[model samples]
Target: MTLATKITLVRLALIPLYAWLATRYGSSVSAGQPDEPFRLAAMAVFLTAGLSDALDGWIARRFNQHSALGRVLDPLADKFLMLTALIVLCVSPWSAQHKVPFWFAGLVVLRDVLSSLAAWAIWHRHGRVRISPHWTGKVATVLQLLALGWVMLQLHFPPSWIVMPAAGLFTFASGMCYIAEGWRQFHHGPPPP
Candidate 1:
């Protein structure tokens, strides 16, 4: 297997580990007290998984090992990791007060769903694929991580009120960017008669 594929697989493996740690520690916390050991361990796991995201891409680019399979696997790993973390953090006892609102979660899932459908439609009609990560998408991912971290850690440390709204805005912006880009790519180099 290529280095990119290997890196993607490693990243994918980390997702479940991170999610397990998050849910485990987050659930272990008492109603009014923080579970320091579990919280720290979970945070470490989450940070490690997030770091692997950048690490895999760096390794792939550095080794010139980019592949179609890597492209698919890498994003799949990211979406799964983030979505799982968010779900766990939202439901964990530690995050009961700072849970990710259902509307935000719905919007996030809807964005991903629409993007997938757009990609599929493009493939069906044009026999092509576009997987470039946009700046807005990157920002949105960052916002999500920050928000999830805050919610997960809020039992030990109070979080700023800005995170939730910021996350929501970035998520909305990313969705809009994806929709615009998908439309442009679909219609590019075409002249409707």
Candidate 2:
């Protein structure tokens, strides 16, 4: 395995850690335990994991170590972490009672699921599918990270009506962007190899 792969794996490994922290503090905060430490800790884990996501990609490309495995694992890890955070934020004791709409989470996961299926279909047809990460997708990801971070923090801080909608809007917009890209790929066909 390449060093990039190893780093990617490490990032994936951190998902459980992030989940545990979020769940632990989320429950406490939801229960009205008046504890800030767990919430803070969960936030820290989230930021750390997000940083690792960026680092692994940089390392992989900077060292010319990109691989098929890295391509697959990197996106998979991102989806998992993002989804896990959202689910924890929505379901934790605090969020369970005052949760972001379940449809927001549904939108996020459904988009990815549909995109994955499209990509697979293209690949299965022996089409040359170059998985060049799009700039819009990256921007969408940053928005997602920020929105989720804000939502998690709101669990302990002043709850904002804007955060949830902002998250849903950006997530939905991102999904639309991916859907358009997929359509382009389908109609125009993958660029000549």
Candidate 3:
């Protein structure tokens, strides 16, 4: 019900719009087709969603509007957006050289699936727990989003290969960090109060 949560909800709403724009109108500006209104609109929607990810988080933290719902929905929105973008990038021919490599996308997808299951199991058993994400997890997500946006916007200055591998590595590392943290929490209980 807070403003931060409202912003998060807006982001959740944008997910399908982003996906629809990306898949329904995805195309390559680098491929020189010219006259790409759909592609342009898709990029705009994607960029807006990407920026809103950070904005909503800042709103929650800066305004002290964090809630249990915010904690839950924030990560859910993030994962959904990332999953949708990855799949669309892999499937669409939207870029000359920035399309996601399947291996990288696959690793990210696999990590997310496992993490979701682990989190769900923990939640079901423990009830309403809010685990802080690792720094590496945050980095991984930023890298992934930057990569996706770069590909979406058709910017090649940083290039996909450099960004994608780093994204994958950070994502895997964060997953491992979460596993270790989960082990500690499940066995040891929430670290001191």
Candidate 4:
């Protein structure tokens, strides 16, 4: 495996640690005793994973280490990380005071589910699916990550009131864009290479 893919694997490995720390912290907070150390550790792990995402991508491009495995694993790691973080922070009682809004999380989940289903359906019918990442989707991802960090770090300065809804809008917009792309591909065919 390439060094970039190895880095991506490390990011995936960190997810479980982040989850454990976050869960422990949440449990402590629910018990009316917040665990600051666990919370900080979770944040550190999360930030490391997030930064490694960028680092790996840069390495793949800069060092010419791109591979089919990297393409697949990178997005899989991102989805797993985001979904895990969203569920843990939003559903946990510890984050009752400052959690990602349920609606926003729902939007993100719904978008991804629908996108995956659409791709599958198209591939099943046409034997292939052409999925080009849209700019809006990229923006939504960055916004979602920022929102996650804001919540995880317990940043109350600007508040979730400002963060989540903005993320939701982009999430919705990107979902629509993907839906339209899927519809076109389904009816016509995968675009030419």
Candidate 5:
């Protein structure tokens, strides 16, 4: 495996770690326990994981180490971490106030799920459809990472009001774009090789 893919796998490995820290700390905070230390640890882990995502992508491109596995695993890790964080923050003692709002999280998850289904259907029909990542999807991802970080700050509430909804909108729009593009691909066949 390429170093790039290895880095991406490390991110997948961190998902369980992120979940454990978020849940352990989140439950404590919800129970009204003093857990700033734990909260800070969660934040550190989140930021590190988030930053590492960018780093790995850059490494893959810079060194021409791209692989099919990297393409699949990188997005999987990202979506898993995002969905996990949103659900954990929204439901748990981690939130200072209700956050990652239900609609926001739902819309985000729905977009991802629907997009995945569309891709799978297209692939099942055509085989080896390389649906390039959409630009809007990247925008949605950045906004989500920002929102996740903002929520983790735990010193803020109002910004989430702005960020999560916008992220949801972008996510939804991107999903539509993917669906349309995938449909076009299936109907028209993959673009000129």
Candidate 6:
């Protein structure tokens, strides 16, 4: 019921809208009549949701409104939004020309799945799991957002060749870091409170 949590929920609600618009735009491109309005609208919704993520986090920290539900919902919303965008851009025929590379998306998704499983195992064993965010993970997330935005906007200046590879590297590095942490947590038990 906090304002920050409310914003997070709103961001979650935007995911379906974004998916619909992005797929519609893709369909138009596949039909040989690319619709600028659908593309732009999808971009607008994506940006709004992305901005709301930062806003909610800032509000939570600044206003001391952190909650257990917020912690769970924030990451869930992020994963959903990012995964939905990746699938829409990579799998949809409309974005074939400017789609996110399948390899990169696969790496991102695999890391998330492995991380989730690791977390669950730790929780089941220890009754609690505490994972402090790593800088590499944060960098990976920013790179992912940049890559997603680049493909969504169809920007050609920097090129996906540079963007995607960099994102993939960071993602791999972060996944490795998480795997190490998870291993340590599993064997050594959760970190001290």
For model 4, how does the per-residue alpha-carbon lDDT over 40-153 read when each residue is reduced to its tens digit? 999999999999999999999999999999999999999989998998887773567578778988999999999999999999999999889999999999999899888887
Candidate lDDT scores, in order, read 0.76, 0.74, 0.79, 0.91, 0.80, 0.92
Tens digits of per-residue lDDT for model 6, 1-193? 8999999999999999999999999899988899989999999999999999999999999999999899999999999999999888887645555888889889999999999999999999999888888899999999999998888878886987999999999999999999999999999899888
Model 1 RMSD in Å is 3.5
**What's the TM-score of each model vs. the native?**
0.83, 0.82, 0.83, 0.96, 0.89, 0.96
Q: How should the candidates be ordered by lDDT, best one leading?
A: 6, 4, 5, 3, 1, 2
Q: Per TM-score, what order, best first?
A: 6, 4, 5, 3, 1, 2
Q: Which pairs clash in model 1?
A: none
Give the CA lDDT, 0 to 100, for residue 121 in model 3. 70
lDDT by residue (1-193, candidate 2, tens digit) is 8887887788788889888887888677656674678777777877877788888888888999899899889888888989888777667744543454677777777878888888877676656665566666776677667668666666444444665566667767777876777777777777776
Candidate 6 Cα misplacement greater than 4 A, ranges: 93-96
Worst 10 residues of 4 by lDDT: 92-101
- Steric clash pairs (candidate 5): none
Better of 1 and 4 by lDDT: 4
RMSD of each: 3.5, 2.9, 2.8, 1.1, 1.9, 1.1
lDDT of 5 by residue, 1-193 (tens): 9998888888888777877887888888777785787778878777777878888999999999999899889888888888989888777646556356778778888888887787788778888576688899989988887777777776465566687778887888898898889889888777865
Scanning candidate 6 in windows of ten residues, the lowest lDDT window is 91-100
In model 2, how large is the Cα lDDT of residue 125?
A: 67
**Model 6 residue pairs with clashes:** none
Error of 4 at 57 (Å): 0.8
Score candidate 4 by TM-score against the native. 0.96
